[model samples]
Target: MIEFALPDVGEGLTEAEVVAWHVVVGDVVEVNDVLVEIETAKSVVELPSPAAGTIATVHVDEGTTVDVGSALVTIDDGAGAGDVETEDEEPLVLVGRAPAAAEPRRVRLGASRPSDPPGPGPVIGHRTDAGPRVRTKPPVRLLAKRLGVDLHTVTPSSGDVVSRQDVEAAAALTSEPPVSAVADARETRTPIKGVRKATAAAMTRSAFTAPHVTEWLTVDVTRTMELVHRLRADRAWRDVRLTPLVFVARAFLLAVRRFPEINARWDDEAQEIVVPHFVNLGIATATPRGLLVPNIKDSHLLDLAGLAHAIDALVQSARAGTTPPAEMARGTITITNIGALGVDAGTPILNPGEAAILAFGAVRDMPWVVDGQIIIRKVTQLAMSFDHRLVDGELGSRVLTEVGRLLSDPGETFLHV
Candidate 1:
């Protein structure tokens, strides 16, 4: 019997919630056969079988969060199952939260060490006789990265090169993933004018194409608001503008470290989900031209003070109507502040290609329960919408919950800040 443990599907993902199982005991499987769909912090990934085997026993129940390297299944591969080496190292992640140094590992697809000789052509920088033979675009590379598939193993159906269809076919094992955005010219079209033409057309295409799922959570942030007030009086923050949004961004960044998948993109053309190591956090600003979401490049690398300064610069440039065109594009995830407009919360449409968008509602004085005492605490609502195709309910809920948790008790996030 081969003992299979859960692998870190996303960078720094220590555990995953088992979303669904495609197999049970007594079933024979082949290499790369999908065994189960697991929701990691960043996205829902289908774990493939490493060795063909007969039914044994599944160790964990559905919806249970299994830690990295814990045995998930015991498969009977018969007598022919060779001496497979078990991984003994911890998950090494370049981005997001750094994995614990002593965490053990298990058998997984594309398992290899940095010192190990690289796999063949089909992956990023796979070399051919001339140099590298993989003829796929960035989207295909992104898809392969997310699926954890080796490009060298994928055989393209058409042409003398690997294509998106080939990668999707190899990974999804189902029908092709739908193209992300599609715009149609219709008679009921709104005129090609200002924001309606610029924003509506693009957003309509995103809404119709991407499968969006939004989750809401109400959080008590009285302490968080108080912290902001305290920071404003500090000499370190004297030059920087400290606002609730800055704290919200900090909390969101802290959550991203735990749930990195929220900072991902759906490369529809590449036909796969893309998880970025760095966070290009988009701040949604209402402007005279239209609703513009200019993002902070490498926001994850910045500290709390740096984030506040970045937010100030981004908002200023946006409101001045001098925000560059490049800044408006390439947002991985977004944060929309509805409280500024006197709204609590609203379902937000995702910026095109981004996997998720988070909405921060108005924080106000509300009656709250604190240690069995009735008190007025600063409360707020957080609404999050993510692509259902990439993110499931479990993943979405955990990310939103983490954000709310940090806000409700931000003292825990000081270590990260």
Candidate 2:
């Protein structure tokens, strides 16, 4: 019999909630066949079988959370079905035989200590004879270190084990100093455990780790808006919702083709640069749960209508909180539509691992030079933030300029090249 242990799905995920099961006992499964769908802290991931076998038992049921090393399924190899032995019979060893047993090894504690040991110094109640010290666990230690709190100063009142609440209390005390103020306002605190927590850590890591450089440019998107208006009236786009975001996505793809370096990542461990040939276009979306950047696979290969369909599907999945984990991984580039939130323009941060991110601002009627005279035109601002280590100033400028050019002259794009 062979037992299938849950594989490590992604980076440092210890456990996952079994959202669904596709196979049951006595079911024959092939290698690479999806057996179950699990939800980790990052996203929903599908677990596939490793080998072809007949499943003997299902260890976990739907909606149950399982650890990483736990047995998920048992498969029967049908090799030793009739083998049986009595209790008096000795078990056979794979090797010839075991050697004679030897005495066990043991170490004596405090055997080499001096008579008069060093004092505990200024630490109070730190007894040397108190069997072992009661402190936080490994995870709690990491949390305290991240929060910049000295664990020695924390008062442990919750018995020997420190709970998450204790760590949170330590964090709160260390984050803010003593301040005296009159209570005149009511404030509510929301726990950051789910998507909000993950997003905050990612943004903080990206901001501090990468040297961010942002460039802003105002563009006349009159032609792009006109194209959107015309497409909305067409019969093909009748059922489809055409917005400025669609045009922005297409332009970003075109820019990526022109500037390939912008769609690359710096692999610090391997001492190599990874430039993806295909574009997994990530659309930064604001959902009811939190901010998510679920992406569309091979978005650069999709045409105008295909891109529209892909964007619509991704947006709907994100809003429903059913976006798959595989779709969110290996994103080559990203675009955030700050324009949808009625913002003119703002600097955006690069998605972790990606070299660049483009921010599309709100399009509004603004004065522009037309035939050497100022006229009201549909204008929008484009902000591009890139990692200086991977993308230089000239490459960033070229990518942003290409996106702006495509938007300014949508019809000319087809005629020029």
Candidate 3:
């Protein structure tokens, strides 16, 4: 038997959470078959099987964090059951860095007895509270059994390894009859990990680490709305989905060109500013997993039609949870559409390592003064948060004002119709 261990993923990933298991025990798999799905801090990656064989056992449960060198699965490589050995002696085999990395090398440590399932956490031996069998002291296991709680379904309050506390919490939900508990009400506690946990840590650090100064501008976007309508009617843009946001994105790129400093990052270590010549415009998107900021590389170079296609592809991939890690990193600036949720505006948090973030509000009909005359116009609010260390009051204000100006007049800001 061969033991497949987690390999070094991109960006020096020391550990990853097993989001799911594609193959269970006793399933026949082939070389390069997708074995599991893992979520890193940056993105979700699918790991492929290294060798073709029958899956003997899975070392860790779904939603369990694992180190790189730890064994993940064991395979019957047709070498017979006697060929099994320990993982330390044999070198782990792995492919290139693109796909999720896992060091899959078979070492036959022999199978666990029928009564004992595979160990949790690392493959060697341990118990965890994730998806597989729940791990705990003998007394806690007895408590779970007595309370009729399926150890597999119970959530652990502490480490991946289950504790008596986790079992007690699980028992509390049923400590009282369900019908009676419904009247009393109860708190459903969800384990904070994976994407949700990572997002919280990142947002918290971003909010506190940077001195953020947010500015807002309400703009009359009547012309921009007209442009969106015209583009939708045009056959030339039939393939691309053109919304008010396409124009907003283009306008933001133009504004960045006018004020290049806004498309830069603050390098505190060097005590200098680092500016890039190209723009990698990040579009903040919400997914079932969490909020992801996947950017278009060299966005400034794309025309209107190209930009629309890029935005659509990026957003669709992000929503599908397939956005690659490369696309999420090194973003110069980001734009989040709070309008999609019927919100008028928001102060969006900046993506870590980026200079600024802009929030696009919903476009709506509102009372306006057009040349000293009362009129109803299409309008939206633009709110931006910038790192005060890199972008001062004057520069941040200029960027927001420019974006508003471009939306106010499409012909002046947008290129290629």
Where does candidate 3 stray beyond 4 Å? 10-13, 54-56, 76-184
Off by over 4 Å in 2: 1-12, 17-38, 44-66, 71-189, 412-417
lDDT of 3 by residue, 297-401 (tens): 999999898899999999988876677777887788999999988999888888887889999999889999999999999989999999998999999999999
Ten-residue segment with the worst summed lDDT in candidate 2? 85-94
lDDT tens string, model 1, 71-154? 777665654345543433543222243322221233333344332235653332112233343565433554564454567678
Instruction: Point out the higher-scoring one by lDDT: 1 or 3.
Output: 3
Q: Any idea what lDDT model 3 has?
A: 0.77
Distance (Å) between predicted and true CA of 260, model 3? Answer: 1.5
Per-prediction count of colliding residue pairs? 6, 0, 6
Ranking of all predicted structures according to lDDT, beginning with the best and ending with the worst: 3, 2, 1
lDDT of each: 0.70, 0.71, 0.77
Model 2 lDDT per residue over 1-417, tens place: 456666666566677766555665545565556666666666655566554555555778654668876777765444333432121133212123233322222213322223213564332112233234335543344345435555566677677676546767877865442221223348534445446667888899999988999999999999999999988898977887678998889888988888888999999999888999999999998875578888889988888778888899998877655676666777789999999999999989888988999999999999999999999999999999999999999999999999999999998352121
Deviation from native of the Cα of residue 94 in model 3, angstroms:
11
RMSD of each: 19.3, 16.5, 9.5
lDDT of 2: 0.71
